[model samples]
Target: MRKWGPLVAVCLGTFMLLLDVTIVIVALPDIAGELGASLTGLQWVIDVYALVLAALLLGAGAAADVLGRRRVYAAGTALFTLASVGCGLAPGTGALVAMRGVQGLGAAAMFATTLSLLGAAYRGRDRSFALGMWGAVSGAAAALGPVLGGVLTQGLGWEWIFFMNVPVGAVAIWLTLNAVAPDGARGTRRLDLAGAAAFALFAGATTYAAVRAGEEGWTSGRTLAVFGVAAVALVLFGRAERRAVDPLLDLSLLRRGAFVTVLVAGLAYNAAAFGVMPYVSVWLQTVLGLSPVRAGLALLPLAAVSFVVAAAGGRLLHGAQARFVLGGGLLLIGGGTLGQAVLDADSGWASLSAGLAVSGVGVGLVSPALGGAALASVPARHSGMAGGAVNTFRQLGFALGIAVFGTVATSRMTDVLHDGGAARELAGGGAAALRGTVPDEVLRTAFASGLDGALTAAGVLGLVGGLAALAWVRSPGPEAETEAKAESERDRGDGVPAVGAGAPASPGGA
Candidate 1:
């Protein structure tokens, strides 16, 4: 237990970072009302936080390698805590939004260094368990956010949501300094400032286009311009990464099977989770008319099941084949999400909870398994890079999932409402009422049809993701079993740096 204290602190930091993503959604109306934010401004409040975090992930990882992980981690905690206070105290929505973005920046720094620090602190079985625990805790945090946010928003105030982080973050920072060693890696690598800037701009533009496409329509000049800029910037960023000596991200890592597969899985997992959850919340509150607190409480089954399954999954890892475990998990997730397509006004909490439970179980199974697989594929020396790469893909997946899923949900809702005779009625009292408290009967009729369609679509996408993984990730038992036999007869090769021999000096692998 003592040996794992630092790991727990890092996991706590990770949990806090992920929790902020969805916690704010449950309080969106409150924030908007207090700050009088426009719809576009409200979108920015959410998207900007994700955008900044995604953009800085790779750069921050490299920074930790140079600056010393403990120093960077402590500074990140301080920045994040300070920003949270700023968010809580902000007089207006714009101020809160800006502070949230600052919080994201701090989160990026901490996220990049966390796993690397854990790797340094634990070894063998203990290290694997720590990584698995981290993954489990992160997922649970995402699931728990709405409940915690709703409780705070309803019982205390929205400001308490941000303020809640202060104590938790302080504890984490304190533990980080005293329990963890100074640096995870020794290096004199230069920061890829230009690459970082370009990547940030490109990611922001692309994500902006994806998110706004539903609201602004595909043909809107602003949306088109965002996509265009994103395209150009992405191309330029790729070129810059290829040419840089020490790039913020090592694109070459893309060639490895384990790394690439896990990255893909990471993307798919986020796409499913982000795409599905928002709609579920809407179904419960907007269609079913549950209060925010009630809606939040509805998620407890998923939370409880996910926590238990994730805990069990770590034990399964020692005996199971990675591919089999991961593929099966994805399949379950797909099955559960698809089941949500059956949700309607009449469906009770049992049905909803069951679907969420299945998805949660699936998520629990695959999340950490993929991370461990990715790290194992590389030599121990490259664990930091491998871990960072995995996280980058996960964040990118999250951004994409939210963007694409949000587009689908919004478009579907608009279409259904426009076609129905009650469209104007919905646009009037329903919209107005929806801006505040949602009543059950009103929510039931409003979301009954729309929720089914959205969940069905999300489930299909999830199932497709699962099937794709199944096809690509072979059954691990036979191949791995055979390899085990061959290994005893052969000498394990010495570690060779993945960087090719005689490769000329390029500027960034910092």
Candidate 2:
């Protein structure tokens, strides 16, 4: 019980953070309607959270190593809880977007430390099992997000979606404070302020550019300027890290093919899964005219299949080579996404369901195996950094996916509408304008064309990721496994206390 306490606390926090990623997606239309926000405003609401999270993750991980894992984790929970309240109470689109950024800050801190804390709490085969469980929680939470969001948004209101996080986060904070152990010693590493700033700018600028390009033309001055800024920042960030005493990101890790492969795999998996999800949700509601609850229920097969497959994949990680598992997973995602691309105006729920189930299984297999493999490839001491690296890429991939694929869908839709002689209607209003003014047949056909383009691009990305995994990822060698067992035995021999054993447990040993 003591050993598993920290895992539960961390998982709770992880569940809340990831749940937010997908939960808001289903509620976007409601938010837009109430706030009178444009498509750009809605995109920012989603993008800002991921953008902030990706930018700050590396710095947060370093902070965890220097400050304290439990301390950082608890602070994050408190901040996330507070931010959720603000989100629920927000009066306008801008306010909600700003608050979501704050929420991302808290999420970054919590995500940066959770895997490291888990690594510290368990060792050897126990470690593998614990991580598998952690992976399952992640898959399940993401899967549940849309359904839960639909239920809350439909029954209570969109505000309740954010409000619900408040009580759950409060409990997570309490559990973290009582159940997690303190770091034995803090490292005296210098925080790379310059490197952190540069990296943040680079990521933020790139995301801004992508989003702006979708709204304006790709060659617009604002988009080009931001892209230029991003390029400069990326170069500066590399230089700063190379010279820093204790860099936030270690460039040396990139030289390892396995590490780079896993990072790429993370990016690809998220690009196809998280990136494509928002549009799909919107299509269900806006195009098919399903209510929020029905749309959420319709997504059930994806979540259910993902949850089951992820658990199985985690168990398989103990013996299977990561390359095979990851590669196979990516292939499934590619095939699934390609299947979705075949949808036309005549397609129904059955077509969507079949594709979603395939993608879910792919995500399930890749999610845990990718994280576990990335962490294993790195030295134990740098576990926090490794986790951050993997997540950073995943978030960036998500941002890019949203930006690029969104552009494809929107542009394609516009082109279709224009070719059909509805350019004036589109110009008067965006998708909303089409709802009442345009003919149903015209609207459906245009939307389907846009979806086909987006899904095809996503499928190509997935296939590329699969190829990278097969080429670069490898399983742990025999010596590595032996060393891991030896380390576990040594920790036991030294009588290192299990998590929460030295500290007072929460009430009822939560």
TM-score of each: 0.85, 0.91
Summarize candidate 1's per-residue lDDT along 52-163 as a digit string, tens digits.
8878887887776667767877898889999999999999877988998899899888877776566567666885677677767876776678888889988998899999
- The lowest-lDDT stretch of 10 consecutive residues in candidate 1 is 501-510
lDDT of 2 by residue, 1-510 (tens): 577888788888988998887788788778877887676677777888888888998888777766777898899889998999999999999999999999999988887777667767776788667667788888777777899999999998999999998888987888787777766756566778899899999999998899778777799999999999999999999999899988876788778888888888888988887687777777777777778898888888878898898777655556677788889889898888888897778766566788888988888888777755675665543444666677788878887888888888878877867742243223212456566766877777777787788899999999999988988887767776676556556444322211111110000000
What is the Cα-based lDDT of residue 299 in candidate 2?
83
lDDT of all predictions = 0.67, 0.76
72 Cα displacement, candidate 1 (Å): 0.8
Find the candidate with the highest TM-score and give its number: 2
In model 2, the clashing pairs are: none
